[model samples]
Target: MESSTQLVILAGLVIGLIYGAVGLLSGFCLMSSMRGWLAQGDGRLVRTYALAMAVAIAASQLLAGSGMADLGKSIYLQQSFSVPVLFLGGLLFGYGMVLSNGCGSRALVLLGRGNLRSFVVVIVLAIAAQMTLKGLIAPARIALVQASQITVNANSLPSLLAAFGAAEATSRALATSAIVVALILFAFAHPSFRRSPGQVAAGVIVGLLVTGGWFVTGFLGADEFNPVPVTSLTFVAPIADSLQYAMLSTGLTPNFGVATVAGVFAGSLITALATRRFQLEGYSSPRHMLRSAGGAALMGVGGVMAFGCSIGQGLTGLSTLALGSFVAVAGILLGTAAGLRGSLRVQPLAVA
Candidate 1:
């Protein structure tokens, strides 16, 4: 294997392990967070997410400031910002997260803990994602993006600022600093969040893991002969890639995303065993399974369209300060709110 490939695999494994371990330990579920905040008035998990976003934005911008990573080259920073697709996708994903009571990453962690239902979720999600990406639904997806996307000269916040006469470097710094400060204030505004060390740690570690992924792909894995796509953690495409790898190991080689996906599973399984959190679980009935399956399918398709899942768009994409990320996040929040409190809300199991 080439050195670049080896580095990518190694970095991906390290980051993935940390993500799994931290996620498992912290119970970091974005779906749960929103549900808790909306349904029960519990804000700890929501605050945790805010902290993670703040840290990711700050750390990622610092990495860019130091000239180590070119985040602008990432897919999220594309000039053709898709609006309608992202809005629709985010809506689907958020609603699905509520239905399934978890997102892709959460499903992985739950699977590690022996949730057979998550196995179904993973498979369905992967297949649905694959279909949207390159299989049956590709044509429609392509049409949607092509029709809805609007191209800008510069899609990043800093570049947009520069277009308004701000110096590029100054704009970048100011943007990063301002966003980080605002997020931190919001995250820490609640006294309960400041008191929860585990939640705080979860936010910090997960955010840094995202930055680490960027460094690996954009910096260490940067090769003149074969430059890796500048990317960080995202679950949609990676899950599909992992499924393809499982069936075509001889013809295909594992990349950072695949390795990261595998590592998360392994890391979470190991942690669950070591910490005595391992337990077997399954659906309450066929109806439950059907609901979960439907949710998974929506999530898979939506994630592909939006170019990310909750964590993918929420943290990794948002880290880019891309205008589209903001739009996507808003859609997700709106969809989640609808699911949690509106007519579309999916109720929990009635008697199980």
Candidate 2:
């Protein structure tokens, strides 16, 4: 069982590496998608992201319905829900992503393109996230979780459908189909989005990567003796966890999240180097540097509180159709809007 679990984890690493390479190569970024749609009136990026979310939901549901995996064991669909944490975390993460000029996946893409600022953002995000996850701030986080917990039996939409007397397979299939159709309709409705094959393909592939992470950890990492935490892609805490693992690897075993984070950075680096895009750059000003650092720290704290970042809870967790994930995603959208539309004077880079 242990060996089998190890194999599963190893397979997840490989899948993660593929995902990282594709994401970097294609410049996939949920943050940019959302921000662009809201701020610049260009909905293509957000539409692509939505399409990916739909694919992730449909594929994950199919996997679960076929008995290939069970998403209930994953952290996103935990029986206990916390609204304050989810909302607060989402707000922080959204603002942070905006201030840093990217999310985790975006950082990886930019790093590949020789952006030094993104490198600092990634490093700060990883460190601060680790600080919130299991380092100095963990005690406070635990206490908060204990205080705000709300218990429920069926945390996922599929399980809710199952409660309504639908057969397990039927419930999952119907739910998944509804979401996929909605997403497909939305994506195709926008002519601009429909024309971008790179964005479309990136969305679909990234969505699959989320589902692939679930399979790698939930099914593959399952073991009677040494079970792993159920999770998919999320940037905030995992970045921190990766940093922690680098320092404490002798005392801890590699988990899917940590491995995936490492794979994303390394895979992007390889792609960048191979394509001659790798370079080191930094913030244009002290104010910009401050924004990046503060954003990363807030993302670390908020991501842990909310249970995921945009990709983690928004795409990966939502794939399970979990109620908490939905709430978190909603909060993310709202928070992102606040940052983009509010009085803070958030501006896009020229990127020339």
Candidate 3:
């Protein structure tokens, strides 16, 4: 209703559009990247992902450093968090991503390209996330958090550094520089990745979009009377919120998340149509459908518990250097590894 809110919503839509387009064009999914690197022995996509993380951290920290945004206000920087719960959630979301063949954002992009399989994934994931957030699963989730959550003086890497006697700005700069440099070096280490300019650009743009989301909420929407939630790009809860808003439009007002979700679908749809990439697709069989549905449900519940999905914890949350984000990301990587390799790997379906 307020002008600042409207601006934030508009910004969210624009950011989502860019993200959807970039994701579709560049194949920017962590699951796919991991599979490529670990299974197929390709590393370009993974490099792009690493670059995105680096850029996100650099840009986000710059914003925070300049006092343009308050990174501390975000949920990832909580003083008390349950390590076990977050790690478990990440593992579930990661394994589910492998089963579903993508994350929530990827499903949205694919759905826009007329993948009926992704449509199923999106719907089921949303339902599962909603249930976990507020339905029958909420009590259990809450209880677990209450039981395992621990309090700490330093909630993030930078904060921890500061607690160890480093100046606030010095801590932020040191942490950001170290992580960003390492990621960038890793991304550029491969000649193959260095050759793909489009992928490189996609990574940069996606990272900027994450920072843009923070700016929209933390700066543009920082109204004293109607303060918006200081947050950025994360898919799990947003996708669920989008679905709820769709069904209950009369009572609910659209937020940045809802607008971004809708924009992602619309952007991907338009791009697919223009590029002649839109095509109808469906599950191969009942067994395939069951697998997808199960994966979606797991992703829903897991994403909620972890406080983010691949893009959420992996990129946006990590940009803040939160200790819990590191734990969750580690869990996700391990879970993805389990699904992609070793005896526990989910094998390719045999075509009947």
Candidate 4:
């Protein structure tokens, strides 16, 4: 039998490679999607995002229906609802993404594209993630979660459907199909989006990546002896976890996120070098740096509280159709709107 670490490491590398290639190729950016719709009146990027969400939900539901995976095992989708936390977390994450000029996945992609400013965002996010995960803020987080915890299970649309008398497979399939079809219709309805093959392909591929993450962690990582943490993509904690692993690799074994994070930067660096996109760029001013720093920190804290960044909870976790994900996604939209809307004067600060 293969060692657990070996299996996990292999999965991580594979997932990482896929994500890196996809990130580099498609220029997938949730922050861009929200910003485009709000700032520029362009909905192509948002449509791409919606397409991915639909595909992810459909594919993940199929997996769940097949009894190949149980999405309820993931952390973000709790049985009992926490509306306040989810909304607040989403808002924080959305604002932070705007401040950083992109979400976690977008940041990684930008880093590959010779944007040094993204490097600062990633570093700050990672540090803040660590602080929230097990550092100074961990206790408070734990306390808050415990204080307002509610008990619910399988908090997904499929579950709700099943509760309403639909069979397991039927309910999952219906829920998945409805969401997927709606999203695809939305994407195709736009002429501009139809012409952007690069963006469309990226959306589909990234959707696959999200589901693949579930398969790697939830399925392959399932060990009767030493099970791995059941999770998918999310930038905030992974960065911090990556930092923590770099410092304590001997003590802490690698997980999918850690491996993926490493792969993103490494793969991006390699791709950038090959494509002549590599450069050392940084903030032109202290204010710029401050915005990046603040945005990253908010993403860390908000991602932790909300249970994911755009790709993490919005796509990967939400694919499960979990109730918490819906709440979180709503919050993210609200927060992004606040930052992207000029009427609110949410200007992007200069970098340090």
**Residue runs of model 3 more than 4 Å from their true location after superposition:** 350-352
lDDT pick, better of 2 and 4: 4
- Deviation of model 4 at 103, angstroms: 1.7
Best by lDDT: 3
Each model's total of backbone clashes: 0, 3, 0, 12
Q: In candidate 1, how many Å is residue 109 off?
A: 0.8
lDDT of each: 0.90, 0.79, 0.93, 0.81
For all predicted structures, in order, the TM-scores are 0.98, 0.92, 0.99, 0.94
Candidate with the greatest TM-score versus the true structure: 3
lDDT of 2 by residue, 67-182 (tens): 76778777777788787778878888888888777787678667766788877887888877777777898898888778888998778777899998999778778878888898
Report the Cα lDDT for residue 263, model 2: 74
RMSD score of candidate 3 (Å): 1.0
Ten-residue segment with the worst summed lDDT in candidate 2? 343-352
lDDT of 1: 0.90
- Candidate 1 versus truth, CA RMSD in Å, comes to 1.1
Q: Candidate 3 on 1-352: residue-level lDDT in tens?
A: 9999999999999988888888888889999999999999999999999999999999999999999999889999999999999999999999999899999999999899999999999999999999999999999999999999999999999999999999999999999999999999999999999999999998999889899998999999999999999888999999999999989999999899888888888889888998999989887789888988998999999999999999999999998999999999998899889999999898776432
lDDT of 4 by residue, 1-352 (tens): 3586577767777777667767776666888887787788999888889888877887777776777666778886676656677778889999898888888877876787678888888888988877888899889888777777677655788778888888977887888888889889999899999999988887887788778877877787788787777777777788888878888988887777888887787677777788887777888888778888899899988888888888888898789888888889899888888888856546865443
Q: Model 4 TM-score?
A: 0.94
